[model samples]
Target: MLPDQSYHIYNHANGSENIFREEENYRFFLHQYEKYLSAVVDTYAFCLMPNHFHLLVGVKEEAELARTFPKFETLEKLVSKQFSNFFSSYTQSFNKVYTRKGSLFIKNFKRKPILTECQWQDTFLYIHLNPIKHGFVKDLRNWKWSSFHGYESAKNPSKLERSYYLNYFDSWQHANYLMNIKKEAIMKEEME
Candidate 1:
């Protein structure tokens, strides 16, 4: 969660429940995410599964955060608080709509630092392919809730930092090819 650092942020629904029950739920969650997180973090990629979601984000520089939230004591605290608010806001609305109570997500979300080039590439692809990996979809592109479509369509300029990641590959096709190769390698290892 440090400034200018890349992290893989993820969380799952509590118990056997699904975080998103319908298509509107997914859209609402994303809308909330953008409203709360867009200023503190630059989203690189994301995927919203039935029970979980993953986000690859780079924490914005302290200076940028200062500009966004001028009264904050620390940039880290500001960013973390915003994320907490994001979750709470979504959960509260979801609970009211479903007439359910208690926590919707685990105590705290998990975040892993992306320290190496390999980990960064792998995490990006991993987020995009999660629906397919979980058997929710056979093709990555068929999954409507993932940033893969954003990257492929190059339409969502406001959300994903697509150009930054695309620079690592020769083309979008090349990126997909490498992602499939990585997926195959992972599946092979899982089988062994």
Candidate 2:
């Protein structure tokens, strides 16, 4: 069931290292991302990878969210249209730069609902760790591309819902919780 009630989405990259390699490409993607984020719903966490991105979004209304996407008037179409906007925006920029043509992403963006308290916590930790997982930095604190530092320590530098995030965990404990996520445990749990 899609947008069964509004959900948190997990969207992956096309192949690998495709989206956030160059400064210009990253900027373009971020601009569209910010635009789309502004258009609908609230985001709890987001991680932009070289090839893909992940988001933890709270849906305001499943129907309204679907309506905002021009290509989709229904929840099912929302998935394709949403990614279409992202990849199409990026590809248009990329094509002009490289004089290339064709799709940038593999296909539609992936989606999943954060249906449980454990899922909410785990998904938050997972997205925050993306930079570290990919070896972009030695610590979650080092990645400037993510919302982790914004939520945990600094001001809402990314224009995200920081006040809402602040309700999720104690300020002091936020860092500890993210740092101490056991990879094996999370993999097992999320898989199941």
Which of the numbered candidates is closest to the native, going by highest TM-score? 1
Model 1 bad stretches (over 4 Å)? 155-158, 185-192
| Model 2 quality (TM-score) | 0.74
lDDT of 2: 0.65
Pick the lDDT winner.
Answer: 1
Instruction: Report the error of model 1 at residue 33, Å.
Output: 0.3
Give per-candidate clash totals: 0, 1
Model 2 regions more than 4 Å off:
1-8, 62-83, 181-192
Tens digits of lDDT, candidate 2, 1-192: 244333456555555536566777766776887665555556777887777777777655676765666565566556445556666777788878877667666665666776676676767777887776666865667777677766666543656666555545665377456556654454455558
**Candidate 1 structure quality by residue, lDDT tens digits, 13-104:** 99999999999999999999999999989888999998999999999988888888999888888888989999999999999999999999
Cα displacement (Å) at residue 138, model 2:
1.7
TM-score of each: 0.93, 0.74
